[model samples]
Target: MASSTPQSVERALAMFDAVADAPGPVGAKELARRVGCSLSTAYHLLGALTARGHLTRTAQGYVPGPRVPALHRGYQRHLGVGAGVGELLVRLRRATGAQAYYTVYRGGLITVVDSTAPVSDTAEPFVPGPEIRAHATAHGKALLAGLPRPVRRRYLDEHGMARFTDRTITAADRFEAELARVRGQGFAVSVGEADPAYTCLAVALPGPRGDGSVHALSVSLATAEFRGRRGAIRGAVARAAAELVPEG
Candidate 1:
């Protein structure tokens, strides 16, 4: 059996990434331009990827296929958060009458693993995505605060706190002070830092014993409601985090 060349593998992966990054189905010429490859090469690779179920082609161009969703579901299962975690989020949403979320920090990234909201006609569902800014979100702050001091400092240095809303904390010193407060209080709260209309409260959970991973649970509500029930929301989130800890 012959081994594949590194160049071939790199080119294939580059094409795949280009397709995935596109807002919608992309044409062969556009993909070729993005990947800096010949049109023929791009078409050949696209056809191969489509045949393998990694992509699906339509009259429009190509879109992620069933395999992508299947892979994503498998990855979620591998994370081990499970249906029970979803149930807990739902319960939290009901109790607080707000959007509930479970987020994890791994490899210097904070990702919302699960959420439960939209329980009623008046409520809006919490949707998690790649666009969430870690420095401005309550759960992201909670996860960051849970990190060791040196690691936290290094992260801040690498990713300079970019401002999102007017309330976003852009100063490193101020943000560090906020993290100190979060550590002391055992939770973090954000008021219109990420988005002006929403307020969020989050509590960090202990990750696997020796691992550096940090996980947090959060509740988001309308700013008006959050302002009125801040203390109650904080207590509720703290309790929920404690309850989520695995028993020995």
Candidate 2:
């Protein structure tokens, strides 16, 4: 957000984001540190969140509350996601033994609405509104590849290709070439480019009948694990995506 945003509102939102990005339940002390707020401010903000049903206190720490899923389900419904999509994502995770992500391109940005457990230290957080460039994550790139040239150019213009690693494609011409390969290969891939420890593969899924939303299926694993079984992982994601096309 910009400087005009209220300081308390910014801190509270940042605290919530820290909780969402956390691997497990987080304590108020850690939340304060992450958001650069004082301990008392953290407690007050956490209490507000708990009272509003945005967070739940647990034996270990605080985690997402029931309101989070309710909001998420409503978002998915607006995206035209049908039943069994969550089950399909779980199955993809079981079959591939990697983190599975379900994403949709909405409001000219790619957003991950659901994801499975992480297997390692590799975290390629692609959720928009956090200053993350679309080019830094495989799912974003895959969705971008589905966009028309003029639209893609406008997106890149609005959000510059901020590099996360040396391997990331920052140049306009190079990224265009990369999108060509994604089209030819029928999938998009990131190898130690977004995050040095993670490798991701994604396949775009056609939107539902009469719906023009951009969607994709993705799996992320440690770079070392992706060494030899890349094809198998790709197939797993492809099969999952195929399962959705017929229902749409």
Candidate 3:
């Protein structure tokens, strides 16, 4: 068996990243140029990724498919926050006896960084990781509401509004109202299928210039448990969020 060249692996990784982060569909020639690989090598890398479902060819050009997002899910697992969040969610679940989650905002979309549940029940409660609807999850809303006005506006414009559940705040006016509420309360909450039979509470992780980092801590539980423990859970979540924020 022959060992793959380090340079080839590096180039392939670069090409994958370039395509995943591209604002829209990317052409093979431009992708090759951006990744600093020869056209032939770039083509080969693209084909390999496409074969693995990472990229899909469209009428315009090559666009990332679900596999790119899946890869991103795994990639985030290696970020600095991933290790920290794992411990945090575990502590949070112990403190609250419910599922705990942490998510990061990427390009206005929310991505789960880590999560934990007090009990390992068989219910497929939104598995940790993968991009999630920013408006529907308390974790996403908390982080998004904390972002700078300009960035938040741009995100809204780009993603527009997509309804996930009847309870999802889709209208711009109503969503803004909800955001205002999050700002005033310093946390966010989701009831029922905005995420399922769960209730979620989240708070933003502060960022430089108070610009708001796309990161948050959330605690979730069956609606019954949450309703019974709402007050205590809210306090615990707020404290967790404070702990996660960097001190000035």
Candidate 4:
């Protein structure tokens, strides 16, 4: 589908995404290298994006421009989710003693919209976007398990389950059985499947949304600790989910 778009336009959008996903300001050279374009082409795209108010040049590097937040506001408005999810995640993290994330499945993609803020500098922050390995993440599995069997099959057929870690289930028959287990258990659990160091447990929000997006909340912690506290963590996520209101 993106092949239909002009090359320069596609590259510019790719460059913008690279910048947006970066932890902090990114230099043109790094952005160029990251986006697989020449320095001059990177500059041209940067200049165009800067003029369009999507990226801002700084003394150190480039940051998201003012238009970024406005666009994000529109996205939130369009989806009608994430209103109180932030606060809920904070409480969920506190209760679960693990990082909590809010995710939604819409338009055939699973996106992380919000997560509890890191309490320390060394704590990792969750990035909001669509990515791979649905069979390897608790939040992803929770959302996928909620969809109709046909829709789930279509997604798997297109994505072709890729393995991320030693525990990630890439075989179709096995993964489908895992999803069935998730449905019967009323939650999704991942034991170092995605990262090999963390365990995640996720529970989907009840019912359908006006936008037809499936939403879920998940918490992640050290695999060793999660093993001993599964009941407590699962209870915390489920309790927190009751407070979330589905947009009509």
User: Which of candidates 1 and 2 is the stronger one according to lDDT?
Assistant: 2
- The clash count of every prediction, one per candidate, is 0, 0, 2, 0
Off by over 4 Å in 1: 1-24, 77-80, 116-132, 246-248
Whole-model alpha-carbon lDDT for candidate 3: 0.75
Q: Which ten residues in a row have the lowest lDDT in candidate 1?
A: 118-127
Give the TM-scores of the predictions, in the order they appear. 0.78, 0.76, 0.64, 0.88
Candidate No. with top lDDT: 4
Clashing pairs in 1: none
In candidate 4, the residue pairs with backbone N, CA or C atoms under 3 Å apart (3 or more residues apart, or in different chains) clash, namely none
Give candidate 4 misplaced runs (Cα > 4 Å). 29-44, 117-126
**True-structure RMSD, every candidate:** 5.1, 4.0, 10.5, 2.6
Error of 3 at 13 (Å): 10
Cα lDDT tens digits for candidate 4, 1-248: 33898889888998888888777899999988987889999999999999989999999899999899888777766777757777888888888889888888888888887767553444453456674767789998999999998888898888878887889899888988999999999999999888888888999998787667888989888999998999999899889988987874
Report the C-alpha lDDT of model 2 over 1-248, residue by residue, as the tens digit. Answer: 35887888998888888887788999999999988989999999999998999899998999988798788778778877777887998999999998898877766666787777643534445432232556867787888898888888988898889888888889999999999989899999988778888888998887544555578889888889998899899989998998886233
Clashing pairs in 2: none
Encode model 3's per-residue lDDT on 199-240: one tens digit a residue.
788888777522244677887778888888888999998887
By TM-score, rank the candidates, best first.
4, 1, 2, 3
